[model samples]
Target: MSWRGKRKVEKPKSEEETSSNKNPKLESSDDSDNLFVCEISKNRRVAVRSWQGNPVVDIREFYVKDGKQLPGKKGISLSMEQWNILRKHMDEIDEAVAENS
Candidate 1:
């Protein structure tokens, strides 16, 4: 038996990755989780995520300016209606933050 045959290599993928990739774009669990992440800088970042089984929302901002994790503002739970209202004002909120900085 010659060992010169081209061997097919298969890359291992996690269950989460497989599920997300197999599902339709709109049906992705991550999208439904009400999670959003944005990079503010090389080390600064912001994330918005929903609480378990609730419409409650949370926002966190952090950074790693110099190998250390820098702390930032954090917000807690919010009502579903309140979240909707916030979404509507997202652009304005961003602008306000930018103006403040």
Candidate 2:
């Protein structure tokens, strides 16, 4: 038997299944609870949010879905420690950007 013939192909999820599988925390309802939110661009944002009972700095891209802004997978969440470390090196980062530009 060919290896390809043994592979299992999964069917795509239905609309109802896809919608129901979305992470609730990524929904717009959570926006009101954010500590701070700044739109870096039309579809990008930076926000401080309480995640799993701890504060986190979230830098994420967003997409419009059903008239609501939803977080996209291309993003990063930094813990307080990580945020502080990044903050401390802001000058260096700025210098690097300046040099590159």
- lDDT of candidate model 1 versus the reference: 0.44
Tell me the tens digit of each residue's lDDT in model 1 across 1-101.
31112111112234354335332221223335433333334434333434455645444444444454543444345677887998899999999999999
Cα error of candidate 1 at position 62, Å: 1.5
lDDT of each: 0.44, 0.60
**TM-score of structure candidate 2:** 0.66
Model 1 error, position 36 (Å): 4.0
Poorest stretch of ten by lDDT in candidate 1: 2-11
Best by lDDT: 2
The per-candidate count of clashes, in order, stands at: 0, 0
**Which residue ranges in model 2 land beyond 4 Å of their true spot?**
1-32
Candidate 1 global TM-score = 0.32
Give Cα distance to truth, residue 57, candidate 2, Å. Answer: 0.5
Candidate 1 regions with alpha-carbon error over 4 angstroms: 1-34, 41-44, 55-57, 63-73, 89-101
What count of clashes does model 2 give? 0
Error of 1 at 82 (Å): 1.5
